[model samples]
Target: MNRQDIGFVQSSINYQFKNLQLLEQAFTRKSYSEEHPEVQNNEVLEFYGDEILDFFVTKMMYKRFSRILNNELVSEKNEGELTKLKSILVSKESLARCMYNIGFSKFLYLGKSDEKNEVYKSKSVNEDLFEAIIGAVAADCDWNYENLEKVCRTMLDMETTNGYLALLVKEKSHRLGFG
Candidate 1:
């Protein structure tokens, strides 16, 4: 991506990149990298992002649901419950859906052949891109937790809820310092 198009990406994530190249790398896919040769693909970046997302979600869950985990609630939860919540929060589908909602699908630098590949256009690709973008943001911010957290909050659509269960959880989460 050119420096000129950085505005669209930044607008979507609500974070400006100190290193514009990192932002471009986040959107670069293997197909594009194969042809570019010199430019790095998002695989390694995605790897870092995957771990970051897992860590962030796990930390958030532990802190947000400490009452249940610590038996502070009337209906205390077991480790299994926490595991389920973490799984759901960091699931590939969840992250992919979040990214798609952010209009990231329109910005992927896929090659012509990949453009027609059904799998390449699937949620899995979005999931990979989502994580890659997270890694890019983390790198852009020099690994600052606050900066990364803001991107995660925006990219993962974690700022809002629609379902009944989510609403209930958000309501109860206030006791755990979520609000």
Candidate 2:
């Protein structure tokens, strides 16, 4: 992608990275990285982003579901319940829907062979790209908790507006027997 395309993608997401290369790396798949050894795959960044996402989501859930009594549930049950809720919030399908709705696929760098596969249309690739992008943003920016929360809220609001995760928070609350 050219500088213009990168700029466009950044504008579309309302996020600007100090290091543009990080964004480029985030969009790159392992196959592309293999072909261009100078570039890196986003797998490691994705790993870190997953943890960051979990931390933020968990905090959100705790605040949102304050009625849930800690002493009433077993440790395993609490963990399982939180996991289920987090899964709904951070699932590949939801992330992919958010990315696609925002025209992220236009900026994605895919191998020629992979582009032809039906699997590319699936949610997994988009979700990976989303996580990678988050990782890149975290690494490239001096994003504090407040900034990260703003980004998460923006992403979630977009998803909710698009109906990708409209009922997720409510449904999870109901399922957990929280008002």
Candidate 3:
């Protein structure tokens, strides 16, 4: 990505990278790295990002549903129930939807064939990009929890109570006949 494009991305995500290379690496696919040996792929970042996202979202869930988890709320939930909700929030499909909604997965640096095939439109690709970005932020911020949390909240639109996560929960409840 060019400087202007990267700037736009930073602005859109509301976070700037201390090491710009990490940001660049986050968007670089393994295929792209194969074509350009000098560049690193985002696979490692994606892996780390997967863990970071899980940790961050799980923590958020524990905090947000404290009463339910502790059996204090009217709709008390057990550990398994909370786990199910967390799984839904961090699922690949949910992350892909968030990335797609952001409308920036198209900027991913892909291999020639993948680019030709429009791989960015794929759910798995979108999911990877989402995690890759979080991974990038984790590295750039020196593993600061606040920075990671902020980025996740911004990218996933989970700042408000009625945000994407809440909507997803409502949808899941309806689907499971629990609404």
The numbered model that scores best in lDDT is 3
What ranking of all candidate models by lDDT puts the best one first? 3, 1, 2
**1 or 3, greater by lDDT:** 3
Candidate 1: tens digits of C-alpha lDDT, residues 1-179: 55556787787777998888888898888998898899898998899899888888776766666655355553344687777766766777777777666666777888767887744558899889889999998888888999888787777663223332584587589879979
Candidate 3 at residue 53, lDDT? 83
Evaluated against the true structure, the overall lDDT of model 3 is 0.82
Error of 1 at 79 (Å): 1.1
Which stretches of model 1 miss by more than 4 angstroms? 2-5, 67-76, 118-120, 158-179
TM match of model 2 to true structure: 0.77
**Residue-wise C-alpha lDDT for candidate 3, range 1-179, written one tens digit per residue:** 88988997887777999899999999998899999999999999999999998888777876766655355554345787777777777777888877777677867999999999989999899889888999999999999988888888787672232344576678689989996
Top model number, TM-score: 3
Clash pairs, model 1 backbone = none
lDDT of each: 0.77, 0.72, 0.82
Query: Which digits, one per residue and each the tens of the lDDT, describe model 2 over residues 26-145?
Result: 888886677778878889878766777778777787766555456652243366666776787888877888887777766676766666774446689888877787777788776567
In candidate 2, which residue pairs clash? none
Worst ten in a row by lDDT for model 3: 158-167
